[model samples]
Target: MASSDDAPRVFQPLPGRTVDRSAAYHALLRELLSLVGAEAPADDEPRWQDRARLAVRKAVKARTVQGPVPEEWFEPMMRATVHEPDPSFVGHLVVPAVAAWGLRPVLLALLDHLDNGTPADVAGVARAWYHTGGAPEAEHEASRDLYRRYQHTALRRFVTLDDLDARRCLLPGLRLQHRSFPPDMHELVDQAVHLARTSDDDYLRHRVEIQTRLT
Candidate 1:
């Protein structure tokens, strides 16, 4: 990855080529992670770290993945840095204007699917695309609303954080906020704690514990 000073130049917008789209995605992922100095596991035992690294790379460049940013908003997004409420793990999840413009189509696709189908069908499709484990229609709709309301922050996490875990965090927050499910933040924290223990990431575990205590 290049230095921060080179960010503006290294990430200048260009017309995306069909051939290099994947490469560009990898480049974007590497550049994004470089901002946080995230490291992969040692060459010998590389596993989660390596997968996480690759996932980040794949996500940004993923032609299949899409978002709701506007076409005309490209210039603004290029100038935009990942702001607060974005996950602290990956600081400033910035993207070029072209990428932002490209995202509108993707988001439109999702919305189209939602509006075109029944709520149940929308949930099924969103679950498959987002890899959520087939949540109920109401549950998924609540998440969709949360994703809509806090898109930028959610995108930062969605783009970089391991998809499963990020979704785990999001599910509870969304459920609590909209569906009134889980009763309150305490239930959300409890659920998060269980998920943290499901992983080996001490940092996430600590965060869950702290959230548990606070809630």
Candidate 2:
């Protein structure tokens, strides 16, 4: 005969305020108690393959909402199994530090633009890619080496395939040593050179020089 409203208040707040619960809350509370009771102490090296597989599945889902490029990669490279729960089970390890990299599209767009010499267009794509990729910290830089290779391949393909007419931009040498620069510093130097000469602005030239030194 006693429903939740008919039952006495179990919790007291301030002197003036009291709390009451319904049958659903009580049922949920009972379930929570049962869950706590069901928990057991876990081993330090307990089987986490399933957990890891689930985590990678979650990561793949996160990647899919980005766009086609990543989705293509995800469908093939994103599979997981209980025996190999870690994402790096297939190849390179996604370390804690690099795990927060959402820069794949930026790098891809940048390389794409460099090949096409449409810096403004490339910059816009880079921004969009980053937006879709989410905040840089939220993204994992899983395959850096693979990413660089993809960029290089894309650049080469663009150069070989794309039309280059009515464009006055000078083509930077494909080889890094032609500029006699370190591999990591090469792209910045090249972009700076392009922006400086193309803009014909003394300030931009100076800025490029400054960035080149920093890079």
Candidate 3:
């Protein structure tokens, strides 16, 4: 058998060419094995190999009208079909909350720019702000309600924070007010308050500065 490192690189179908089923299957298996070998280290080889196999199986079962499998489907298949949540799952949850707080002013500024028909470089900031911010009281009540709902929902399946400090790895470019879990929840709560204040301040500042200059 050829080593994974020597596996065929091209999977894209050539124009006006029909793919042979046997050849395509071999090519895909080689690619999958190569990806698994490249991503998995020696220490946890078996576990990663199992995950790769499961990912492939799930992808195959879920395949629809497939010629060559779209490459993007593979990673999501790996993540979604995995039996255990990766360590980054918690990190992923925390980053958005931290960003809602840490980037409140910038988001408000972006919204202000958007309202005035000015272009903003930060795409999705406005949408993130709306989803995570709004009226302070409403946002706070919404957070509390979500916490209650999650308490009752499938989120209870996950373990509680055993290592707060270890889990609170600061996401890039944003400074969270608190670094410890549980306590850092206050940082997320404070975002609504900051958004309310900054939205007002930004409105006044823009009116005095940009709008006045335009007038």
Give RMSD to native, each candidate: 16.1, 23.6, 21.6
Q: Residue by residue across 1-215, what tens digits does model 2's lDDT show?
A: 11211111121111110112223323332332233232222324354333333344445444435533233332122111101112122112122102323345434434454445333232222222222222243232443443344335433432343222101111221222214333765564465356445554344344434434531
TM-score of each model, in listed order:
0.27, 0.27, 0.18
- Top candidate by lDDT: 1
Model 2 ranges off by over 4 Å: 1-120, 129-138, 146-199
- Candidate 3: C-alpha lDDT: 0.28
Q: Would you list the rank order by lDDT, best first? A: 1, 2, 3
Candidate 1's residue-wise lDDT over 90-171, tens digit each?
2222222224333333334434443453333232223222322122344434345433533233323332344443343333
